[model samples]
Target: MNLDDDPPPTDAAAALRLIEDQQSATARRLNPDARLLYWPWGVAWLVGFGLFFLRFTPGERALVDLPNWLPLTVLFVLLAVAGAIQAVASKRAYGQVSGDSARRGRWYGYAWALGSVGVYAGLGRISEHLPHDLAALLWSATAVGFTGALEMAGGAIWLDRDLFRLGVWISVINLIGAIAGPGWHALVVAVAGGGGILVVGALARRRQRQRQQP
Candidate 1:
């Protein structure tokens, strides 16, 4: 309507708009809370798998290679998978400092432990009736060695302090199981491995809640 009218805004107005744009971008960028979206879902699936195997019907049991041992097999698989997911999620957890070595700190290291269960089941079938001590020794040695490799590699990869500690712990567990046999190995993992994870998880949760509050 008027060539004489000043073009939409002055240089000062344009500069002000540019500053606001930059601020808006920074505010909207990804933040740690973004993780909350997927975390619950992952946890739900993790628990669901646990309950599923626990409640396996006889019919379902017949399907697996080791149907009678379905509960144990399923349990280990679930544990290993959870470990893998943790590893992956930890890596995906961006814009935050990572405390673990890349793959070593993850539950996938648990995949080896799970596979060892499969080995136990296979061994059970081969013998008319395999002894528990023998099976436990086999599983323990394999689990510890595999877990150690994972931890060692992870320690090397991320130079994680925890990985080295974890490897030491796993190796000790393995050694004890091999030396003492099954009965004691079960006690060690149940009391030490499982219990330790629970304590760690609880502490981490408490810390996380505290951070979110402020």
Candidate 2:
């Protein structure tokens, strides 16, 4: 009896059961819990932009009296943490999988990278010439707008209505925030944009649980 040799074939029914079991296991591993996917960004946006609001209020004096650079630095740090979490989660969900879905995910990731470069690079020169408040508004608005648009794109690719609606909501609020100007923009995004993402994450968790139930 050579251990390396193929085992005897199972009947069709047994083979089917085996396939089903494998699929179930794969699904269990690959389930993209939206909470995990969304919560970190929610927290990042909430805290980061909240800080921004405090440090850069429209009045002559800043509410928190923070150094000019602190809020932006903190925001960037939190965003980096959130991005890392999302990357890890995505890898766990899709690393072993391959096909059209995987290909789409890869392309989408590239889009994020490339789009971010384009936005920042396009703004870099102009930002240096703008006034402080205007620069803040410009940077925040463009970043938020790009993010919302990408979210909509992701929703379309995945055919998820909830995600699509969330993207629309984000874009709308981002526009309102920009219209409101610098300090107010941060406040709106901190409350509405971050808050909305958190709410959607909760709802997605609920839906995922319902689908997993017996």
Candidate 3:
């Protein structure tokens, strides 16, 4: 019996074992730290946006009526923190993955950063012709919706199904918000955009934990 010349395993048990091994290898190649960072960042964005939207609603006047700069300040602070976490996670992922994957992730980050700046600038330029409130609503929806598109692109690049699904869900939510118009923009953004991010984050966390388990 020559082992080198033997046919590959084709029985049900053998096939199952092979599949499991492949999955294990894929899991091992993924960045655990990156997976862990996602849900918390999502939660932070949810809280930040929730507070920002409070100003327009009657129920949370305390949050809404604070100095105009306060909410913006808090939101930016949270974003900075999230950025730091992402940087750390990226470093950890870089250590584990190939150079090409790390470089891809870096370029993806750059694209998002540039895209955000472009969205803001473009919105500001065109806002002059529209009513103030309508312009603001359009700005918010477009900016946030662009983020979703980037997520979808990243998911496709990485072959991450969950992230891809999250991107689609986010785009749908933003579309609904747009259709709802300026009157419901704040509420839609808070409930749909923020909440969608939170849900996606939680799903990512759960999937990561399951993959880590024996």
Candidate 4:
């Protein structure tokens, strides 16, 4: 019989092997190292925003009197550094992999970028009519919500439970902050947004190290 006309394999041994192969492939595609690549980015965000909030605290007056542009500049610099770290880490982790998982990761980055623009623009427009403190609080809360949504979407797309849990934590924290009102806005962002990112980053690093152990 011609090779093209051969029947599908029906042997029990062959079926078992096929199943094992599929499972192996799936495991490889969801490489755990890929998740670890976000650790640095998370840490950077935590540190950057944590410092930003310190200025507002009574005892921490270092950045309080600095030109507003200085904080913005520092934030941009930190973001650039974090982006570089992520790029390098991702290349090391997923450079050899090609297929749906890789494609999804690339698209997820795009989604986050687009979502950030939308959040900034929307918040800016809405802040116009609100009082200064209220506007600031709303902006912070909405930004947190946007970040949570991105993390949740990314986790679902990549099949990462850790990221999904982090997303939920962020959303819940933001909601609580919102309910507490503008008075505690800065504290909420510092504790919830910065602290949450730090915790997640540390957890990711720990998991990565554990997986690498012999």
Tens-place lDDT digits, model 1, residues 140-164? 4665566656665655665644455
Question: lDDT per prediction?
Answer: 0.50, 0.88, 0.72, 0.69
Name the 10 consecutive residues with the lowest summed lDDT in model 4. Answer: 55-64
In candidate 4, residue 101 scores what lDDT?
72
lDDT of candidate 3 over 1-214, digit per residue (tens): 5479777677889988888887876665566544455755565557666666675443424444666565557767887888788777667656756678778887998999898888889888999899855875787788768978988998999998878887888788788878877636656666776677677777877777678554
Query: Model 2 misses residue 57 by how many Å?
Result: 0.6
> What's the residue-level lDDT of 194 in candidate 4?
62
Model 1 / residue 9 / CA error / Å: 23
Q: Write the per-residue lDDT of candidate 4 for residues 10-67, one digit (tens) a residue.
A: 8988978877777766555445454445555555556555555554443425445656
Question: For model 1, how big is the CA root-mean-square deviation?
Answer: 10.7
Stretches of candidate 2 off by over 4 Å are: 1-25
TM-score of candidate 1 to 2 decimals: 0.46
Backbone clash count for every predicted candidate, in the order shown: 2, 0, 1, 0
Candidate topping TM-score? 2
| Model 2 per-residue lDDT tens digits across residues 2-58 | 477777447888877777777766666787678988888888899999999999999
Error of 3 at 65 (Å): 2.8
